[model samples]
Target chain A: MVRPAMSKEGQRPDPESDADHRAFANAAWSIPSYLLSGMAVYGGLGWLLDRWLGTSALLPIGVVVGLALALYLVYHRYGR
Target chain B: MSARQLLAAEGGNEFQAPGTEIFEWGPLWHGAPSWLTKPTLIVALSVIIVCGFFWAAFSKPKLVPRGVQNVGEVGYLFVRDQLARPLIGKDGDKWMPFLMSTFFFILVMNLMGVVPVMQLPAPSHIAFAIVPAAVVYVLMIFLSIKEQGLVGYFRNMMFPPGLPAWLYVILSPIELLSNIILRPFTHAVRLFANMFAGHLIIAFFATVAYWFLFEKLTPLGASLGLLGFVMTIIMTAFEIFVQALQAFIFTLLAASYIGGALHPDH
Candidate 1:
């Protein structure tokens, strides 16, 4: 494993890497929650729509759309 | 009496796989309140143990540290450098007392699962896990509001910059639910589910070993019993790793939340 260069005093010379690692971890952990919440919110709306319109299709559509939107959100926020 | 005769006397020869009943404990003693179960006792003991250990380690500071203080410094530095500093940025050290206590406390509670007498991890009970997660949740919200003004905090959380105005309509609710509702729920469940499942698995293997080796020790069953015994040992070792990891993750997430609150832009 390639270790990051350390200062003579033995501290990590690059604090940016530390921050980047932390951000990566935070983003990774948050992804699942974002996906689940997205599914719940949209799929739930779709369910209500299906009940009102007497069509059984919107729930799955809603779930898919929610999932896509969630992915897009993650990409927009973290993928950069 | 032979194992066969003992099995015959028991009337039910089938092995009973350990289940949720292993997780449930009736009080420590008769007439004790229903709430005063083993998990609760372990939680109380964890609190005392953590406090006592830290007190012993830090009560009298030595310029050249020795013994307990050396172990204490290692723990302190582990939380400070690995958890607090990396996640929380410059303000990390300020939160050491809270972060360190949370890490060690949860670590101890999780470790109780592998301990001989206290074989239940307190956080395996959802309630124990929830208390700490909820505390962090409430603290996060409070800190967010305090650091960022009330409206600013909600605005920043609900609507991230660089996104087009129209996208906020659909995306904002996801952010709201993820941040406000699901974060703590997942936090608690992650610890609870891991410990609960780990305990159940260990208990299952232990029961298998006991039943096969002693209760009904057929020649074929002896090898299976040995396997169970070996697995029980292996799982216990794995559980210790998992216990420590969960504690680290729990504290890391808590620090991240606090860091986010303190520095919303980050």
Candidate 2:
């Protein structure tokens, strides 16, 4: 929840708070970036593996690995 | 009761059409319904709900939060402190609201299936999931490229710091392709497929359960009905977990994408 305006005579929020909110919004760019990167990497691997192994399973395999890696990082961070 | 009569009772939860696919939207008229079928509608509605809820909470901001604001803070704080902050470190606070909104949006869309009137899971539709998945893809790639430079990012992602020459040759392409091409597609597909399959599972069991309980026209119907009823309940729980799990996975991956982008070497 947002804190009420701190001014006794109705002053504005500290510039820092506005800056902080702006920063949070900007961080959203990563959603598109990593997702694209991961897909490109994983899709390519799937294709390569499919060619080498003669199976369609490589794509799913790559997915499982990617998901695991992502989850691993989350767990590692929160584990603290 | 006859199977026809059993299924004809549309008001009941157990009712199902004989040949219809459960939850299948099969060609809406000539195409699909404009409001419900369009991916934009789903995404827009999700945003509205989340923003509206939060705005309501903060409309009259409070020093000591209460009710909805309190619940909202708990969710936001979890994302900010737990997921985003640690992953992005000091700069993490910047991404909290984005991550928070994304998590709730995806979670609600995923859970739509279990909600009685909203029988369809919006994320089950690839078009809806693809947008966010694509967003994550671009974010990760840009971070890597920005931090490591194109060549450096490629090297960092494809070739690890220490590996034997022979392994390098093998692992290089695998890692390159995996990190570059496949991640976003699968990320989208995973959510889409899970929701799709989930809807189907609910449909299948629901139809069978209904038939067993009411339509078979035999004493054995009662026994089959019990089995189906129990299964329906169990599957409902399973579906709920899957919905939540997919949301967590989506958000976690989104955060990790930022994490990897910020620290490609790690």
Candidate 3:
């Protein structure tokens, strides 16, 4: 395996750290899509339910709940 | 007659801000195909320019780079190091041809918004943006299914490890929709929206400057016209930065998507 060059301090850069950094960026970029999808899915479901049940509040509730769930997903996946 | 002359002739007319109408280009000539509009022509020109540039740069390899080849190498190194290597890992070099072409093609197309004759970025048309993004999306799906079996790809995407099985019922739908549908949608929209908005804003400022300074020149409006003129210059400079940045971001995200598909565990 060809190793990366050493730092001035004579310490080799850890390859895993680079991969971790990339994973971090990827997670950050994907978070918005996840949040939007979460809202769309649950909100659509809630809107359907509201039409069937003749209620108007479920849509807002679904959106808020979906947003919270998406945040939780982000935290669970990326926050260690 | 030129737009300026037409507007100037209409004395005392109100300032008309450039609108979505500015983006609507008819065919280059009467009786021409509707699809043969300015943007389509610019896209074709951009393709030729990108191909011609690389051909000139690399047609004859030099032991030591000089002139266009030097510039080409710099571009290659920037994409490889900044985008491909960082995002796609060790396999980055292998995918250079695809990623490099994507980066340059987009950069050149986005830059057309600033070029004098071709003031329209091709990707602003949405269809241009969609085509490249769709290609990447299809490639991503193909790679994911090929590397990880079709079932494995979906399992890994929808049911990420470390999540409890019961929770998967709710969260899985989000993951599936995001990865399968929203990812490419957002990817294409990001580039299209940026280019569309940037070009519109610059046109708005330029129109303001032209309308006030020439057509409706008055003491009160003169200052505003000066302000518009200054803003036009500033925004054009900023638009150049934004164009390059959007191109970089589009490529970066493409690489990230490919990286995810190729190495799902990451």
Which prediction has the highest TM-score against the true structure?
3
In CAPRI terms, model 3 is classed as acceptable
Residue pairs clashing in model 3 are none
- Which lDDT value does model 1 have at B216? 85
Worst 10 residues of 3 chain A by lDDT: A1-10
Tell me the tens digit of each residue's lDDT in model 1 across B1-266: 22233345557879867667666677878899988888889998999999999899889877667888778877887787788878887668799999999999999999999999788899888999999999999999999999999999999899989988999998999999999999999999999999999998998888789889988899999999999999999999999999999999999999999988987874
- What ranges in model 2 sit over 4 Å off? A1-80, B1-20, B26-43
What would the DockQ be for model 2? 0.10
Instruction: List per-candidate RMSD values in Å.
Output: 4.6, 8.7, 3.5
| Weakest 10 consecutive residues of candidate 2 chain B by summed lDDT | B19-28
Q: Tell the DockQ for candidate 3.
A: 0.38
Write down the worst ten-residue block by lDDT for model 3 chain B: B1-10
Chain A of model 3 scored by TM-score: 0.79
User: Can you write out model 1's per-residue Cα lDDT over A16-61, one digit (the tens) per residue?
Assistant: 8767866787798899999999998899999999999999999999
Residue B57 error, candidate 3, Å: 0.7
TM-score (0 to 1) for chain B of model 3 = 0.96
Better of 2 and 3 by DockQ: 3
Q: Against the true two-chain complex, what DockQ does each candidate achieve?
A: 0.33, 0.10, 0.38
Given candidate 3, what's the lDDT at residue B133? 97
